[model samples]
Target: MAKEIERKFLVSGQRWRTFADEGIAIRQAYIVAQDDRSLRVRIYGNGQARITLKVGHTALVRDEYEFEIDRDEAEDMLRHAIGNVIRKVRYKVPHEGHIWEVDVYEGVHRGLVIAEVELASIHDEPELPNWVGREVTGESQYSNQSMALGISEGARLHQLA
Candidate 1:
């Protein structure tokens, strides 16, 4: 089984931009969004698409299964998604031997920047960059699933930040 182990943080400053690569635009939507498991479809700027199934309740680790799908099928699934489609640009930044994915949200969730670093194991602790602000690892409110489902509330929260 594929396990996803990562830590999430709020981006504090613009320092990360210096090390970030050209970002890729991404659009994703949830087909099944339950508390413990979720099915998501994502389309990238390169026209590639994928459908992922994630199962587990823990924040740091989850069983993940991803499969490539036709872009048209993915778009069709997005239309039937449970919540609002998420739009963001993801940039990869290498820091201290670890690659951090920084997601800059657009559309309704603009101004929200989140950085996530995936680890080989749950015990691994990657060095945090200076631009990383508060750690929001286990916060469900900051999860993309929650944001997509509660668009209005999420937008308001980010606007107030």
Candidate 2:
């Protein structure tokens, strides 16, 4: 099985933007990953997509999976996503020796930004970006998917996913 493991964190301030090395402009991928509210399919880029299943207490997980999906197809694949946020402020930060993706959300999640680091193993520590604040990798509140649908601890967020 293809599994994506990573961490999540809440954006403290605008310090991340200044530390960002680059940003990318993206559109919807046109696929769905949500079916039973626990599983979802994500499409990204031109033809990039993945299917993810809610593993456990996502809140306590340091690693989370951000699936790519199509804008139109996202409605079915994902249920907890908030609004139509296609563009993400993606930043490349080096951690340990690996690069972390810090996405400063746009549109509804404009005020929300988080840093994520992907590793081959959960034990590997990567080089971090200068703007990288405290690690919220295991907090589900920082999950992009959760933020979209507003299903965190007590976050009464708007759900348009």
Candidate 3:
């Protein structure tokens, strides 16, 4: 079982750009958007694709199962996905022995920027960057599943492209 322990934060400023490497464009959609479990398909700009299954009740930790799939299959899954698919550019930034994934949303979610850092353990304390604003861990409203489903009011997300 693969356990994902990570923390999420809102980006406060553009300072993260200084340490960011070239970003990869990502498109993801949810097959199941339930509160306790979800399945998602993600396609990357590099033609890579993956389907992920996550099960958990909390935002901080989850049992994640991911499998690489053919791009065609992933695209097909996206078409059948529930609600809107999410499009974002993911930038990798190495800071203080941890790699942070900063996601810059595009399309209807253009103004949102969120950063996440995975930890070795749930107790692991990652160094917070100066550009990180409020910690949004365990916040359901900020979750990717919620965002993709447009569960929050006023966020215009799109379906499979």
Candidate 4:
């Protein structure tokens, strides 16, 4: 079981680049579900897919399982997704004792940027950088998966990729 607990922020400037060592460009799709506390699946890239499920929970512990799946299977599963699959630039930054993945939203979600850090344990402490904006950890709407779905849910929003 892997528990991911970290903070997310809206990118205000290029300050995050200072800590960036490397990054990978990924295409992701988030499936729509009625419950948020329980995430169904997160599809990353064109041929890679991971299904995440919340099997148990406690006051201080969050447990989840991520299984690797073929890209074609994930695409077929999410073929009916409501939103658009957007293209964005994601950069990896290192800070404290953890690595942070910062996503610079392009296309419609442009002008929007965010950073996420995955923790080995739920009790781990994370150091914050100066460029971090609003914290949106529990906000589902701010989730990258939700943002991808937002594209088709409404009119097409354009941003320079």
lDDT (Cα, tens digit) per residue for candidate 2, span 86-131? 4565777654577667776666555556667766776766665555
lDDT of 3 by residue, 2-65 (tens): 9999999888778999999999999999998787999999999999999999999988899999
What's each prediction's TM-score? 0.94, 0.58, 0.94, 0.71
For candidate 2, the TM-score is: 0.58
Q: What is the Cα-based TM-score of model 3?
A: 0.94
* Pairs that clash in candidate 1: none
Between candidates 1 and 3, the TM-score winner: 1
Q: Among these predicted structures, which one has the highest TM-score?
A: 1
Which candidate, 3 or 4, would have the higher lDDT against the true structure?
Answer: 3
Question: Pairs clashing in candidate 4?
Answer: none
Q: What is candidate 4's lDDT per residue for 66-157, written digit by digit as tens?
A: 78877777767666554666566678887777677888766776666777877666777688877776666756566655666562323123
* Alpha carbon deviation, residue 26, candidate 3 (Å): 0.4
Where model 2 places Cα greater than 4 Å from the true spot, the runs are 11-22, 26-37, 41-87, 152-161
Q: For model 2, where is the 10-residue window of minimal lDDT?
A: 28-37
* Tens digit of per-residue lDDT, candidate 1, span 56-154: 999999999999999999989988998889999999999999999999988878888899999999889788888998888888878898888874455
Candidate 4's displacement at residue 101, Å, is 1.0
What is the model-wide C-alpha lDDT for candidate 2?
0.52
